[model samples]
Target chain A: MFEHLSIQLIMGQLLIGLINGSFYAMLSLGLAIIFGLMNVVNFAHGAQYMLGAFAAWFLLTTFGVSYWGALVIAPIMVAIFGLIMERLILRPIQHLDHLYSLLATYAAVLIIEGLMRQQFGSSGMPYAPPLRGGVNLGFMFLPWYRLWVVLFSLLVCIGTWMLIERTKLGAYLRAATEKPDIVEAFGINVPRMISLTYAFGVGLAGLSGVLAAPIYQVSPSMGSNLMIVIFAVVVIGGMGSIVGAVLTGYLIGVVEGLTKVFYPEAANLVIFVIMIIVLVLRPNGLTSGRGTST
Target chain B: MNSDANAAPLLQVKDLRAWYNESQALHGMNFDVRPGELVTLIGRNGAGKSTTLRSIMGIVRKRTGSICYEDEELIGKRTFQIARKGIAYCPEERAIFSLLNVGENLTLPPVLRQGGVPDSELLKQFPNLRERRKSRGTLLSGGEQQMLAIARILRTGSQFLLLDEPSEGLAPVVVKEIGQLILRLKAQGYTILLVEQNLQFARLVADRHIVIEHGAVVDTLSAEELVSDMGRVKNYLGV
Candidate 1:
């Protein structure tokens, strides 16, 4: 299966896989968190991601904020916006069916895309790389920024794990996910937790956008397109555990990468194909988690 | 109503009505829970017992009445916000996060003990939780899960807990354990609102029973008064 592929071709596919893996991991992590804890699948997650990238572009091009500044500000601003959406919009519809929630977020995606189109022309905006050079890894040359994204994403995923699994607040977040009513009965501010969970999920999507801006064009259509692939990732990973999302993202990224080395034609189709197989074999996902499962 | 009782009622519901879209579920339900009072809402299915709990916690849709906790208006608050206002709700489903282990389930909510409830104290109070600390919530026996559910709320330090059907699916021995736990919470100065179908259990544990049928309060009576009128329980609950 691997005979005809050159070592260079193999490395090329693997590196791209890693880069794609970073986004899939981050985006799916956010989706899983929001869905698991707050019981909202956050269809607008990708749009939020695009919004982050565009915010960075707008900040740098129009406001003169540095790429570094936008990296922090864009995610924060979008996160605050998520908080507002939760308070002003999502909270009211919480009692409706899960389908209503899914529709509500889909509407949010449309609203965000419309606003972005009005502000930035329909044409995609280019993002210049913040840090300039690539490091030669004996097998292939790796861009400094691409490597930063992987490492930073790993740190973020781990940090989030620690916060939820080890910290006191994480405990609360998990508790809220399990039984918000029960947790609230304890006199704790569970609504605040819901708002923050949404913010954190949206913020992760924003962070992924900042990382992708230089690599991909900042466009209104970015999130919707990537969302489909990420949803596939969520399905295969089961959207239950944070680790499952991140790990399966990278694993599938590599699987797709390996396929490209041997047969480039199959690379794009592999994720969806795998998603179908997984759904058939284990519809509940790789993790046996219950509650708001994607 | 006594001296040194200046603090507001722990929970107060006035003409609180709730609906699921167009259908009304709770009709002008009026009730109050004094500090340290163990309150139970007892009624047959479709009697607005669960709806009253959901409406008070802001988990139900289309609520149109007053829900005040410590004199603060709770009508507009979200379920989580109402929870933040010092309330915890355990649904009738026992919706414990199934995948999370017993310890994880207990630890998930913010267990801040900043002049609030503490987890260690709860573990101390419910030794069953500590004993089965490593078990998954779903894997635990029904009684154990119920105990863990109660323990989870206690861990958060919320003195007021809205527990729905803690005894509904448990074994007889487990039901007895639940009754004991309710008394334990009452003894510890915690106020509880329970929706119980186990009349025997309710009679053993409840401080007061507020009976409802078709969304309106039909009766309020003491535990001793209830045993004497098993006829009423048979009429209202058909048990």
Candidate 2:
């Protein structure tokens, strides 16, 4: 059974895993940041991501905007929506228990997805790849757009990690996450920082959506399926660790892909299974005490 | 309200009332601090010494009454806005960011005004912090953490410092070091509002001592008066 597996088959599954890992990294990173700072489990993250893909589609269909232009405009549009959501919805109930915030975001998910479904039906819509064609390697063929997604998302994750870890703004963010009142006492406007942080987190999710638009179908439920997987990734990595989220995302993605090759039935269950195991062993996740989350 | 040309109070609190949800912490609290004056708030554990400072800084949200600093009312202002008005607070608990190193913690607070103390002078002032600049905030000893907590705010360029129990949970020698640091800051023309349970430490540095009992100021004594009347101080503090 082991000898029958060809090089092409192995390489293909690995590439698929890498593609899934890119999305996982991007989505989980956003979730980690939002959760770390605001202590709000942003269940609307998936909906916001779907909106990103839809925004790209709408821009292309209505305004004749290219994919490149959508890449720039879509995330900004979604981020503005995120700001509005924070101000109108999240801020009002921020003082309540953590459970309320989770519920509110979950409601937001329903509303956003429902609205999108009403506008565009449940059927999937196609998006043309920004970079067409594939490269023929010795073992397997690789699509340029898939490669772009992997590389671009990798750069994004690294860049975001650097911004949060090495910069002055990052220092304020980290401190604010730990103690918002103390941060405010230091002459910094902490409430405004919370709003901006929520926006930035959602903006990253929107960016991931735009990147996924060309590969996956542009549909209302696009993010819902992936959201659970990303959440599992976040838990396995650690609740709020940036490096853990990034690394665990790719690692799990490859593992899931490997499961598909070895045991097709376990591919979908692998992430959750890993999540449960991590919870039992290390309740704070793999990279504990690295971020604001307990 | 005195209208003397040179004796205007930098901080003035009148009839301040604060509550932690339903439990009242402060009731009709009143006090005043003039520029360059180190006013010590001395009281027993439940007498609202910390609450008075917190209300002044807008940390206690359910607070009412006037907290005028430099003639500007700080009653309705947010914590950061009050901070921007040249007032810095160091809480009794010494809330240092555990994840941040000493160097990072030192630079955390944004300098409000133009002429705040620079990093070099701050590090020079707290030599212990300079030695442990690269160490995590929680890794420091109790004395070093206290020093870092106080030193971090010096760079904010704030005119008034609200220090709450800086001498708490420190050894005698470390307490003396902190007292010396306070005197040095005063000599450099920094106005301080100190909250201390240690009456001896209060007597050493304060120009005036405000005695609080059951959330209200019962007496205001000069440093000379505090020295003259140890019995009254002991009665109010219950030490």
Can you tell me the CAPRI class of model 2?
A: medium
A24, model 2: CA deviation in Å? 0.9
Tens-digit lDDT track of model 2 for B106-163: 9999888976889998888888889989988888999898989999898899878999
Model 2 C-alpha lDDT per residue in residues A1-294, reported as the tens digit of each score? 666578888889999999999999999999999998999889999999999999999999999999999999999999999999999999999989999999999999999899889989999899999899989998999999999999999999999998988888999988988989889999899999999999999999999999999999999999898999999999888888788889899999899988888887899998899999999999989998675532
lDDT of 1 by residue, A12-87 (tens): 8888888889899999999988987877778999999998998899899989998899989999988998889888
Worst 10-residue lDDT window for candidate 2 chain B reads: B1-10
- Cα miss at B177, model 1 (Å)? 3.2
Off by over 4 Å in 1: A1-4, A38-43, A62-64, A84-126, A188-191, A218-225, A288-294, B1-16, B28-40, B64-91, B107-117, B155-163, B191-194, B206-208, B232-236
- What's the CA error at residue A60 for candidate 1, in Å? 3.2
In candidate 2, position A118 carries an lDDT of 94
Candidate 1 lDDT over B20-58, as tens digits, reads 888989888988888877778998888999889888888
